[model samples]
Target: MSTDTLDLDDGTADRALLDARGLTLLVFTSQGCPNCRQAREALPDMNLNVDRIAWVDAGRSGGLVARYEVFHLPAMFVIRDGVYYGAVQASLAHWDISRQVALALDGYPAELP
Candidate 1:
């Protein structure tokens, strides 16, 4: 992983995602961040509707990181219909994030909910 900081908010960063007409979960991460690496890796296993964006713009990554309070390297959230479900961290699990998505859509109100 690149030990480089990231820059979000740029038109060039790869907008890789699974998007729809509704709710989205924004995962803020950098390749150097182990946690971020995990989340990005596990994404393919979770059944979700999402629009994933990689913030490679090193200039604005810090501000975006602070705005989301993403003090950790790897982070995730449960966005429902379209709202902040909060972020969390875990070592690594195949179903951990999938479960979060389940609970979120099922009205779990999120961890912050």
Candidate 2:
């Protein structure tokens, strides 16, 4: 229950899990944001493991949001190997998210289906 740790559904002991994990997608969302709502809805069809992603509420996690320098809503960052890999904003499509994540993690182009 660290101050910087977020409340996760997985019951993970660590709150700073993203900074220590392999490939993690940190999605910054805000209430009443249309783009954020769209991103949430698209999550199910994105063809990615839910466990690798964390949907963070920007309002609730002000410090965490500021840590990432996320000034916009519906922003996502790919963190891997304890490094900030890359980021994408206002993504509404599954392919866009998947491609950005792949490019950040794999260092190559991702083909969409």
Q: Evaluated with lDDT, which candidate comes out highest? A: 2
Count of steric clashes across candidates, in order: 7, 0
Query: TM-score of each candidate?
Result: 0.53, 0.68
Among these predictions, the greatest TM-score belongs to: 2
For model 1, how does the per-residue alpha-carbon lDDT over 85-106 read when each residue is reduced to its tens digit? 5553444564665565555555
- RMSD to true structure for each model, in Å: 7.4, 8.3
Q: Give the CA lDDT, 0 to 100, for residue 96 in model 1.
A: 62
* Collision pairs in model 2: none
lDDT, candidate 2, at 57:
78
Least lDDT summed over 10 consecutive residues: which range in candidate 1? 12-21
Worst 10 residues of 2 by lDDT: 1-10
